[model samples]
Target chain A: MAVVCFMVTMGLYFAATISFLAYLLRRSEALSKVSLGITAAGFVAHTVALVARMVGSSAAAPPSVHEALSFFSWMLILVFLAVEFRHRIHVLGSFIVPLALVSLISAAALPDTVPTLQPMFRTLWLHVTLSMLGTVGFAVAFVAGVMYLIQDRLLKSKRFNVLYSKLPALDFLDDLNQQSIILGFPLLTLGIITGAISAEFAKGAYVSWNPEQTWALVTWLFYFVVLLGRLTVGWRAKRAAYLTVIGFAGVILTLIGVVLKSYGTVS
Target chain B: MHVIVVGLSHKTAPVEIREKLAVPGSRMGEALTRLTSYSGVKEGVLLSTCNRVEVYSVVDDIEQGYGRIQEFLADTHLSLSSEQLTPHLYWHADDRAITHLFRVAASLDSMIVGESQILGQLKDAFESALSHKTTGLIMNKVVKKAISVAKRVRTETKIAEMAVSVSYAAVELAKKIFSDLGQRTVLLVGAGEMAKLAAQHLIAQGVGQVRITTRTPQHAVDLAEKFGGTAVPFEQYKDDMASADIVLVSTGASHYLISADDVQRAVTVRMNRPMFLIDISVPRNIDPAVRHVDNAFLFDIDDLKQRVEKNRAERLQEADKAEQLVVEEVGVLREWMKSLEVTPTIVALKQRADEIKRSELDKTLGRLAHLPAQDRELIEGLAASIVNKMIHGTMVTLKSEVNSSNGAAFVESARRFFSLEAAPPQDTRGESAVDSSSCLAHDMNAPLVEQVPSRTASRKQP
Candidate 1:
């Protein structure tokens, strides 16, 4: 049931991608709605697959790497649907669906190992979930930033093609980028605080500031400066978009580094 | 009844010739009446707009109808002789005439295809023709079907969705740049006519605020009042740039008015929020270098014109789909028209048969004058029954062949064989015989049951 659900979710995302691409090529409003419907269906199937995985588990263990990746992709889709609803930027699906598809496919390829929960962070599932949400938010911001730059380049070059017509306005994309940052920063801050508290309550546990941890701090501070600069120095548009991309890159690199660093302990 | 269309549009005539032939608004009733007064014309409609002048009519004979309408065209515009005007006027007969009328009503033949103005113009023309009492059964059906077909074209195709005018194109582009224009400020830097038109379009789109600034302060005040906006001093316009989302510059300046450095300053002040700068002046009021400024997009009149051209091309592509839809609808209408061919033949044959029966019965009664009145009545009844039976077989044959491709030829052959040419066709002109509602009811009661309309049967009012 779980495998079938995963395949169906993947198929829907692929269909949504084609629909969105067709809209971009034709600048069709009807195709945009079709793409939105397909993506929403894929989101539902993805949510069902996640629930099935949880129900299939024994409940006493922590999520494995593959499960965490699956949950992260689900978070991304959930955030995308919310942004799509609020902004009505159906064309953004053409850019974001491939990312969701790749992450889900990667998760599906990984072995479904049921590992015992770590003693120190067994009760810290809330922190992990919050951090996933934060990263998902940042990923959304990354997509918006990329879209802004493309639109900005097209406008500057004065090449009004189908892609240029399909993209949202520069101002709207910039605003969406700001919104994602606003939603992600506080969630990341709370997740970090909760993780620290959980580590402190565990006996003989010391929260070490490893290189990956330090990198995560730098990513948080980078977004902090971006938000602060937007408020004080009025940094926006191209500069803001570039800074958002850098911040998201920081988050991804830190995540990969931490996962690899802890690979030896997973067994 | 035969349908005929005679007209010249933008395609066939230049503006000078079109203007000469255009019937004035006050003279429309006169024109329609004069058209129907012509020989062989039973019902007529005159459609005269700035783009085209056309006459639609139901007539007794197609050849004589075309000749009369062409003479009327020559007479309406005395400046042009019949010899010169013949090349400009086009005539369509029968089903082709109805198809032409539908295309015009649907705006396919318009200078700008898919425009909504032509539909209203057609309705106005129809209203004038109806009030003049020159439209009869055939024209009534033609007008209603044209209107419904126009509505269908609008709903089924994307031809009418894109903007073809420059001002409308500017508004569409602004909407693309800012998802909601209701919160964006528009700064008009000049009070030119084009600028006023663009401002009106923006206002129609429900923009937040419009500020006008011009060298002529009074003109600025007047334009502001016209659009219900605020007037700002020309010098202070630069100060309002930071607050404005769109800047329209169309001053008749010989040199560039707004420079790149000025736009850069505005961008800095507005926190790099995206700005659209439109320069619609001949000499170009805003410097083209302003496009290089971060978050500042500048478009001149040429760019907007190019956008309009591209949009027009897109609409043209959509018109291909609209034309296909029209072809399908015309085919349906043609089938309905073809079925009416059998009606006239049926009426003629029955009239001829009854006349023969009456003449022979009268002769027989005269020769047997000594016979009683009851014997004469029985002889007359027997004659009528034989006529009815003979016509019934012919009516059944005609009805069965109505759907065949050669059904019309068969009807004509039958009419010739029965010597029905001497009999006149039923004349229901200048009456509310085929009013659309009753026509639909008649269609519901037809032999084909939902396919062909019973036009001839229901086309007799009271």
Candidate 2:
């Protein structure tokens, strides 16, 4: 049942991506609304699949790359839909939905060899979820940042092309980028604290030089600077946008490393 | 007879010439009456707008009508003579005139295509003519048709949706910076006209408060009062920048009024809140280096113009589609006008038949002068019956075609197929034929029908 739901969701995401890309060219409001409807439908199917996978596994095995990646993308779409509902910026769909699709496709392409859940990993589930959710927030910021820089350059260079016309205004994108980090940073701090507690329980130490732990700390510290700078110095626009992009990259690389390490152990 | 338009538009005339020639709304009735008073002009409507001043008229002769319109223009303006105005005026006749009017109504020929203002102005011009009673049947149908064409263009295409002016472009850019202008504060640095217009547009969009500041404090207070806004002392204007979301700097100062350091300080004071600065003056009042400020977005005149140009290009592309709609509507009007000519054509045809039958009967009766009067009457009756029978099928076919979709094709072919046009305008043969055939007296003015067309044409009421 879970596999069927995943397949259905995969197909919907693919359809939504194509619909959104076509809408970008037409710039018709109806088409964008319809495209958004399709994405919402896909999000429903994806959520069902996520619940089914988690309940079915019952925390018996370490999560497979497919499940982890699927969960990450699910969180990403959740954040995206929230932003989309609030902003009503149709152009963001063209930039953001493709990220979810790539992650889902990557999950589907993986071999079904990695264990689905970890022993005692059930206790750390909340920690893992929060961290992934934090990454979702950063992912949103990345898209917003990329859009902000592109829109800024387009404005400055005075090349008001089709792409430039559709993107949200630079200041709005900057605001979104800052807001995403502001929301995500605290969740990550909580995630790090919970992770430290789990490490203490499993390894009898609060700090383990595990690759995942080390990278998470480094990413948390980087975003810490971003949030601090944002609050005190009013770090925003170009600098905030660039930092969000770099910070999200750190989140992504850390995830890739964790996934590879798990696969290396299995092989 | 033809529909002719003679006027100066933005493309043909400078603003100075257009302003001199434009008729004020208060005197539109007088201008229209004076326009139709000319010998060649049958009916007239004067469209006067900031960008163009045009006279749309139905006339007896396009060439004579164009000249008379120039005279009317010279007479109305008084400051500009026919010789001076002639170089700036453009004239279009017949089908081209209708097409031009349609394009104008659609706003395809506007300085900025798809602007929407021209359509309303055209409607007003038509209404003014309507109230003045200067418009006839042709002008009424044509002007109303032009209005409907504009409505169709607006509905069928996305032409008018693009905001293409420099002022509108500024609004678009502001939307990019701020989510809504309704609650944002606008600070006008100087009393520049374009800046005032832009700030006024923002206020119309519901911008909360306006603060006007200039080097001349009295001028600032007076201009500020005009906007119902507060006037700031020039030295204290920078303090207002902290609360102001938008800053419009359009001073003629040789040096930068707001430096990069000033922008940085304002952004810092506002706790890094975003500020949108629009510098519309030639010598930029806002510092160029302000672009480096983190929370400050500055756009000068050139940047705004580039956006306007891009939007204009898109509007022009959409206008290509609007032009096709106008052309399609013109073809429809052309067909309707052709149907109008059917009555005159039928009259001319019967008149020709009478001219032939009467002259031939005269020749035959002279030869049979020795015969009895009763026999002569029978021969004349026979000729009349034959002539009626020959024209019966043609009259029925031509009359039925007036409502058909391809009625124009039939009208053209019928005119060429028959010798209706064979009789010249001064055909004296028509008068003698009229004298003999009293029953066909109404139709006997065949040569006159060539000049005075349709029932309404001779009456002059329409």
Candidate 3:
């Protein structure tokens, strides 16, 4: 049932992505509406499947890394849908659905192995959930940043392409990017703090110089600089967007480092 | 309905002409009343703005409406002749007018594309007309739909998101240098309209202070009072220029208002802190070479206009999305209209046929009273089947022909051929006869007489 639900959700995500692209090309409102509807339905189905798996499992918490990742991706979709509902930002779906699809596919392809829940690893769940949520928030910010940069470039270069035409304006995108960063940065800070605490609890150390931890700290520092630049130097929209993209790169590096380290340890 | 638009805009008319043609706020009610009273006009709305004055109206006779409007303008203004104004007047008919109104309401046709002022202007015009009851059903529907389309374009597409205006562009540029304008100070030179507009925008962005300087102290004082700022002496303008973060100069002076030397002095005094200077004057108030100064940015009218033009082009491109939306909506509306046209005729035809069946069944039953009950029921079923087969082809023809251009004529012909007028007007209060008949066909086991018209003469005698 879990596998079937994952497949169905992946299919829905693919359909939603195609429909969104169709809306971009053909500029059809009906297609846009249908795309949003399908994505919402997929989120619901994926949620039900996750709950079913949780109930069937004998584990006290999430069974494995793969299951945790799948749940995290589902949470991202739920958050995205809620935002879209409140803001009525149909264009964001163009960015979000593809990311959701990638995450879903990755979750499904990962090996299904039940890991023993060590007391320390149990504490790490909070760290993982917080970091994942923060990363998702940053992903949304990155999308907004990319849109701002493209719009800025178009305005500067005086070439208005179809994609440029479809995007929100530079100021609105700038505000959206700033808001996303403001919301995500705190969550990320908490994630790092909790991870440090969890590492101390598990290994009797307050801080570890692991590459994942180091990169996470570096990512946090990047956002800190962005906030300072925004406050002191009054960093303009384009510069801020560039900084967001760089920060997102740090996030990606941290995720990869953590995954590779986990794999190495298990082997 | 024929549509005609006659007026001048910023492109075709000078400020003098535009101002003269502008309908003052006090005169709007009277203007709307007079416009609707003109001959051949079915409905009318007048859009009067500082940049443009246009009258949008539907009429039975386009030429007559156009002439009357021209004459009305001549009579109101008293000095301008119809011939003199005719060159500036533009006329669009039918689809062209509809497309023009939609584009204008969407701000795609504005001097600055995607400028939101036009939407408000259109709403004001609609409301004014509504107050006077000058707008008819056609204009009401068209204008309401146009407003919805404008909103959809703004929300669904990215047309209205950016700074397409020069004043707004200046503020956006300021944001690029300083993320937050709340701590910055803005200085206005010469109290020009453009400068005032830029000052208003800066204030809205949370600029901490505003100072206005003009060659005429009273003018500067007036502008300062309006924007809740302070007026400074014109001679002290150079001294204050160093203290200000952003300076906007739009004066009518032929000579440069802020020379390169003036900026160099200010830059040195301010310790090379970044300063933005915008010169919107026609002849260029600030020296273009000042842009060469280290950390001192000077943008002339041309540069700002170029950016605005780029934004306008981008907005136009985005308009394709809005256009696609409009096309789809229009298609749906046209389909609904066609369906409404066909329904009434189908109902009338079905009622007439049902009445004929009931009368014939009654006469046959009277003659067959001596037959057994089961055999009578069998004969009645056969009669009903024959009636259904006979009407099937006619029904098909009616449904097919009802939505054609000559649909009304076809319906008229069918009504006459069937003598449907004598059928006691079958329950026009209920659903259409076609729908009722389909429901009847689906439930064939039910009594057929319930679906048929009762005898009209028996009801009249009672």
Among these predictions, the greatest TM-score belongs to 2
TM-score (all chains, Cα) for each model: 0.57, 0.58, 0.47
Per-residue alpha-carbon lDDT of candidate 2 for residues A12-69, written as tens digits (9 for 90 to 100): 9898899889877775789888888889999999999988877887555655778767
User: Model 2, residue A171: displacement in angstroms?
Assistant: 3.3
- Ranked candidates, highest lDDT first: 2, 1, 3
Q: Candidate 2 chain A: worst 10 consecutive residues by lDDT?
A: A112-121
Q: Ten consecutive residues with minimal summed lDDT in candidate 3 chain B? A: B433-442
Candidate 1 per-residue lDDT, tens place, A1-267, comes to 777888899899889878877887895789988888998899898888888878998665666656777788878777778778887777788878877886777676666563312546655676677777788878888988999999889877767798888888887888888888889889998877777777678744435687877898889899899999987888888999999998988998987775665454564
Docking class of 2: acceptable
Question: Which residue pairs show collisions in model 1?
Answer: none
After superposing candidate 2, which stretches have Cα over 4 Å from the reference?
A112-118, B1-164, B287-295, B310-462
Retained true contacts (fraction), each candidate: 0.75, 0.53, 0.00
Q: What fraction of native interface contacts is shared by candidate 3?
A: 0.00
lDDT of 2 by residue, B168-249 (tens): 7788888877777777889998755457667878887788889988766776787779898999988898888888999988
Which lDDT tens digits does candidate 3 get at residues B1-462? 455677677667765566567775557789888887776776788887656778888676778878877777776676777777778777775556766778787777765556565776676677777777777545665677677777767778887654337787777667654545877778988654456667888898899889888766676776689888888898899999998888988664545768889998987676545577888664567988886665467776566666566556666678788777767654443332333344565776676667777788889989999999998888878877787777667677767864343343455456567665422111111211111110011111322111222212221100
Model 2 pairs in collision: A61-A117, A61-A118, A62-A116, A62-A117, A62-A118, A63-A116, A63-A117
Model 3 spans with C-alpha error above 4 angstroms: A22-31, A61-63, A114-119, A160-166, A169-171, A232-236, B1-188, B191-212, B224-249, B253-279, B285-462
| Candidate scoring better on TM-score of 2 and 3 | 2
Query: Best candidate, lDDT-wise?
Result: 2
Judging by DockQ against the true structure, name the best candidate: 1
